[model samples]
Target: WDFLESPGTDEVLYGGAKYGGKSWFLCVWSYLRACAFAKKHKIPKSSHPLKVGFLGRKVAKMFRETTLDTWFKTIPADGYVAKGNPTEIIIDDRVKILTGGFDNRELVNKFNSAEFAFFAVDQAEELTRDEMALLRLATFGRLVVNEKAIPGKGLLTANPRHCWLKDEFILNPIKQRKFVSALPTDNPYCTQKYIDNLIDSLKHRPKLLAAYRYGNWDVLEDAEQVIMDSWLESALNRHGEYWPFVKEYIAIDCARFGDDETVILLMNNTDIKEKIVMPYCRTTEISGRAAALSHQNNDCELVVESIGSDLGAGVVDELTELGHSVLVYTPQGKSSEPDKYYNCRAEAWSKTAKVLCSGVIDEDSNCFVALTKRGEGDNYGLDDTMRGQLCTPHYKWVRGKIVIEPKEDIKDKLGRSPDHADAYVIAVWAWPFISMPNKSGSVRHRKRQKSPMSM
Candidate 1:
């Protein structure tokens, strides 16, 4: 009722969990609004409706098979018809509803030229912030009623994910937006058998149950997630907090070519100064550039990961020859505690997770660690990709020892390498091992350096 009755809010999110009638709500609401406009204006029967409303998910096929199916089943069949290759529904000779997905480049391009009176995206979490912004922009100045433009109103429905939607609507909401929680229990039509199955399936995973059944956005991670969502949030909240440190370091995850990205993070203790990302670059080129950056930043120790590839080893050699102290992080090496972990990599990741969760978890009260962005200027130092990657990989027990999933598995799951998270872990892993003295007794300020590629 808030979504349909509230005209002040330009954007409204309806549901957060499955079986909440989210798709049905969006479809029925949009269709009714379009029909209302048609009835009020007495729009003449024509081929063009003068404006279009959009309804979609990430992929058109899935949208058609699922959400579109719901639309067909719920709406009145009379005077309503779906046409075209993908599908566009025309209702009562006035309202036109265009349906497509972000994955369909052609359909998305068509949306670029179209103006919408109403729009709704089901399973909107699949789309990025930019895509959502584009959808909002398409509705601007186009929602005309009685020949006067009204505030652009739209609906979004999604399950909880650590994405922009959660950050924008759930975490911090603007005045023009409203978020309505819709759980399976809220739907009277949802059968007991279905709910029982959902409960039974997710009983072993409490976090998943919290998100899927109860609509809890706070706990989004499962049991195997190395970094919990709360831990990452705590780390992000620690930004701008004061903590003194003298030692500085640079951690690099190198990628020479292809779709993989190279990430270099500069830090003073656990506080990060900058994150440099570059693509399609040589190992030597980036290493040399980082070495120069290290020199520029008071000759901080350079840490490079050299596991499963000689690229990092080559970088170490290059930096060493350039008269810079370098540390090679071979994650495949034996862990310091041989019985606790399958390898050093697993140990490092576990330690990094512990570090991020330090004050919040407090498993070790004496072990206080804070990984934050430097200064009060930047609120969030860690980017979205980095945090998501950090929380992506799961852990397993192998022969009574903890072992992290292979990089290949994570890469496949993420559809790209977990480069940013790996770089962060490498930096955290090298933190205690380096015992260099503070030259100036405090972190000296130099004009922040940016690499040519970085700039």
Candidate 2:
């Protein structure tokens, strides 16, 4: 099947679940275009070579090991030759396929000078907004297929993630093009047994099944924990929980300097229950000392910590003066043990994740209740924390501790503090103390009652 019946004039987005023929279609399109270009140019069998560039995210090696490798195997052996070095392939003596991940700007730039009849972005969702814009500009006025003078057009295949392209590129009202969603069902290659297995897997793992098996973007939006408005509601609900007898409370402070919102979580824990007294997050200009002092408590301890990068030790003096026990933890050099970091965050988040995932938190907590109502089935509130803490690299747990190692290159490139996520790690670390313990007498009585019932 010809995926691109008409090229150059229109933008094509082939997005859906895993094993959908999006990548297959892309490979076929590139292969055919290379052959067509050679034939149209009347190049002798070994004379004319068509050059094609394939771009992926910075983590393209992972892509190569997975999707790109699959594409390589799918292509007929007669027409393609895989190079020993990378995903690069020599096709038909007259065509060259250059494969690159988005990490190298220089490699992407190389395509700007060469005139290629076809350009393909394998996993378009992985590209940042700026990178996508650059790719668009690079392909302008370059695609010429057949005798027909066609403008340069590119093909994008991706599973929708939280991004601007979903709004601007796919759902844009101005673009008069059809948006086709190709599910696993749409692909003849996928078997019914495979589909059944996917459905079964999704029943147990909704998030992965939602993203990879169903190709449902709603799942992505709804499964998120921290929507902007929901976050605001949760933050504002902090004031509503103030009780007159709520003394000797603990505050877990997750500080951010700029761009990142400093999150301060206040909790009142008794023997029976723990209540969130306040959860305030905002971008404040307070120095480290001022921020440390602002959230101090006379009767309670302060878990003031740092992650991503150490702001400074100025907060220690201020926190100590307030008659509070201050604990400062640096996440750097800790993430080398992936199991520890993963387990710590998992344990912390599990307390809340259960509520969020099962939609139970939506019932008991008015903060989450109001937020979910405002979200209209979108889980942006939950998603924020998930994306920040869960999606951020180096959050993997090795044993049971939370570890965070800095990626200087990523930090430099992204130009923002991963502090929001750092604050989450701090919150997770503080989770054990946040909840109130059950009364020992109540537990003993319950055990006695259960013994009589069992008898």
Candidate 3:
């Protein structure tokens, strides 16, 4: 109650394992907050009754499915008169209980014009941090509300989810905002037999059981994920710039068939600025190179600080003939850090992973849809397809060296080559140009690649 009762506390989160009595606590406490004023002052004012609201993602499911049975068992039928589609309970003729749903834009908007003395939400993790901020707006403009007459506060309860709730209340906590850990064991009402049966049913699912039984947040990892969700979320939508020992390049993953599109990633260090995805035929048309010179012109017109391609079959010869500099990725080539990585690509991607996970995830960010701008303080725009490709590849250790999941496996996982993200990794690596210090305190680079076409 430190967070709810403290003068400094305006927000508090009570979350952890399921069946930790989160729903019950919210219900019972909400009743107390509603009826406390009249109980304290026996002769209550007939004029302004106290008002409290409870909300969640869906009004129907929360009220009809989950809270319906519990609400009847807790609040006496004689004390509160309840009614309606929006759901309300009038208590002792001195308080009004309002329930709201924030599952959709229209639903959340209904609350915009309304005000409440106090508010509480269940499963707060299902909503984003921005949505919670709007909920806090309930406390504003209650100048007439007597302090003892109506004390408005915000409360949230959720299962341990890998989202903003963990970011604000668990990992980095402020004194004013409290985080109380509630395990299923903490509830006396939960019988030992019930806990045993729940644990037994989840025995085969380790990650899930850990969260449900012990509330272990660390157990959440998608086995097929190459790029972490938080890392991708932050980088994709992130703003501003940092001193990054900047470098620039374009890495192309050329398409061999009519169906696939050649992907070009424009990057500054590890940060992507743009992606150019076009079929060979389309590119030739756009470059206006007719007849035999069409392919060569199309290749040269890419214009980047530097260019590298995985397809060296003809682009290396074509671009070099056009007096354009180009490098080629040799996947099986020996690694600069042979002991730590299996091949040059593995070493490069290993470095890419470090750079990607450098920052924390920002919640409720418009990053997934933002238009990608170039140069300082910008990021390449990302769509759902790009996000799926970026997050699809997972890595594993073979003989103590990091190896990216196989091409065929990744194709199966993402339904296509991770062409955009692969080219992005190469562009960011910009191999042999700059080196970042590794854990062992060594700067590494592949042995210089031999000339494919001598100047």
- The top-ranked prediction according to TM-score is 2
Cα error, residue 92 of model 3, in Å, equals: 1.2
Relative to the true structure, candidate 3 reaches a TM of 0.47
The lDDT, on a scale of 0 to 1, for candidate 1 is 0.74
| Model 2 Cα shift for residue 97 (angstroms) | 1.6
| Cα RMSD for candidates in order | 13.5, 11.8, 16.8
Give the TM-scores of the predictions, in the order they appear. 0.51, 0.52, 0.47
* RMSD to native, candidate 1: 13.5
lDDT of 2 by residue, 1-455 (tens): 33355642456677767667787778777777666766666645454445544434445564575556656677787887767444566766766767767776667676557555556777676678887766666566565545554455567777756565577555563352335576777778877766664555234346645766777655555333322333333432333332223223333334444444444443332111111212223213223333443345433455556554443244445456555466665534333224323333343333333323332232332222111111223312333442444343422111113223334433554465544444444544453443333323211100011234333
Query: What is the C-alpha lDDT profile of model 1 across 58-128, one tens digit per residue?
Result: 86766887788888889988858888867888886677888878888888887677778778898887688
Ranking, TM-score, top scorer first: 2, 1, 3
Question: Which 10-residue window in model 3 sums to the lowest lDDT?
Answer: 361-370
- Cα error, residue 81 of model 1, in Å, equals 0.7
The residue ranges of model 1 lying beyond 4 angstroms of the native Cα positions read 143-147, 221-455
**Model 2 segments more than 4 A misplaced:** 1-3, 7-9, 45-48, 53-58, 84-86, 143-150, 161-164, 167-170, 173-178, 188-455
Question: Is candidate 2 or 3 superior in TM-score?
Answer: 2
